[model samples]
Target: MCAHYESPRDKALLKKHFAINLPSELAKRDVWPGYQSTFIRRHENADVGDDAVPPREALLGSFGLIPHWSKDDKIARHTYNARSETVAEKPSFRDAWQRAQHCIIPAQAIFEPDWRSGKAVPTRITLANGEPMGLAGLWARWRSPAGETVHSFTMLTINADEHPFMRNFHKPQDEKRSVVILPPDLYDDWLQAGPGESGVFLRAWAADELQAL
Candidate 1:
């Protein structure tokens, strides 16, 4: 259920790959981490993923999720999409899923599904060598009463089998499937270890990094 993704990628394709700088700080964002660009998450607390580092921070939230003893915001219109197997048991994401983690939603493509007969054709996925990839994130920080605070993010999914290129677009999921991509070297271990080895180093990466079109 990736929905749609493609973080723009200008500034010379993130300065020809990492070592970026030019995301001043929120100013009407979301052209896919826009407002300045260069977006990536996972580090609600840290536990691996190269310790989840560099040129990845463009928070301007609102992909659903506004928990913190919520009093409004209608359950974030459905709380975006969080299901890394129930995000540790979601109650607005169990303490940000064990102190929150898993990020990097930079991109090149993402739309999802060819579900076929029941409709939903769409399909996009990417990086079978097309480069650019990152997804699986969760971020939060809400406050406002006099001390404004608003940082939000969410994007994590699984279930999409056999990828010769995102398997003709995630065809499995009638139940028990796979989707979501990342692992070009743990993308920073998930945030940088700690939290009991960052969920076993993000379930161990190595899906050959990616090639899912």
Candidate 2:
């Protein structure tokens, strides 16, 4: 499954999506797939802009995780998402899951697909009013052999809520569900304020905060 996110504003276009901007000294300026994002450390880089120096939080590193153990460097492409279900135990994501939480790439809306007749149709999911949206994600910093630092991010997926409108996208709902839909109520908490698996938070979003078309 793939994800599509839009800008922080309420528009159907793709260019306006909010991507994390890095400081000029941030080292690597590489862009990500779909031209979607380049993640930065929230505590270290969140509030600072490129021109703004001495950012309150130091520039820790960029997203695209660099497993503290890998000596090869290309592992990032495969180590993106740390599945919420198995994150606590996975070697790649486990370390950051409970301690080094990173911010995710957010959007006003994201798209999924409905496959039928051996073809795929895209469906856009967003808030009825069109506010910014967030996906579950993990981040990492990779230091190039040259020592330049780059950041990267990954989108998390759980079983889709598959409202009557979006069900055509995947498979039988009773089987294995996969896609994580975040709701408005859980937005703040998931991003900066809650605790636990947050079932209450997950249910709220799964209920009605989304509209897929």
Candidate 3:
């Protein structure tokens, strides 16, 4: 599960890559579970008659997904990553998954623990081409006790025990997992996919296309 990562600082890169315009500055460079960041989702007017609205829109939201039933924001720390296999049944993720509230988290890179050297060392992973990554995620809207609407998101992960590269992370006894990094061409398709079609896009990314340092 990805708990920490670098959100793309260059708005132009986000615009050029994700094709969404952020009206305000990003919340942070480094993002943790409850930290504020940006996510791209299909615009509500995307399929409507509003030609003025873009197909995609970027919004600032918490890194972790906060379910509607959550009483407070603390749930974020534990819901940062949703396991793909159990996402549909997990109370914290099922609603978002069933609703197909898909989103793309724009990240410069993701960090993982490299434990092969006996001690844990943080390793940075990025695309081989050095462009920003579009991490697959689910978003949800929660209404706080104060009547404020809060938006949060969680990255979707897949088991990586058999993956040639991702299997290298985490402890030997622990289950190896990796966040799903979607290909650029499928960005729109993923956002538009319904509950049934969403499952097909949850597979692990190609190892050769990534670089770990």
Alpha-carbon lDDT of model 3: 0.93
lDDT of 3 at 84: 94
Model 3 Cα shift for residue 120 (angstroms): 0.4
Scored by Cα lDDT, where does model 1 land? 0.54
Taking the tens digit of each residue's C-alpha lDDT, what string does model 1 give over 1-213?
554566644656654553344355422223322122234563234334565454244444555556676665456556656777777788886666677454555667656666655676765556656666666566666674556676556666654444334444544555423435556566666644444554443332234555434
> lDDT, candidate 2, residue 42?
44
Residue 79, candidate 1: C-alpha displacement in angstroms: 14
lDDT of each: 0.54, 0.49, 0.93
My TM-score estimates for the predictions, one after another, are 0.30, 0.62, 0.98
Please provide, for model 2 over 1-213, each residue's C-alpha lDDT reduced to its tens digit, 9 standing for 90 to 100.
443444343222322333233433432223333243533234554345665543222232323455556574566556544455666677776666656454545555666555664556666667776666555565655566777665555555454455444455654443223345555344435555333543333332443556776
> What's the ranking of the predictions by TM-score, best on top?
3, 2, 1
The candidate with the higher TM-score, 1 or 2, is: 2
lDDT of 3 by residue, 1-213 (tens): 789999989877889999998958686988999999999999988988788999999998898999999999999999999999999999999999999999999999999998899788899999999999999999999999999999999999999999989988888889999999999999999999999999899888889988998
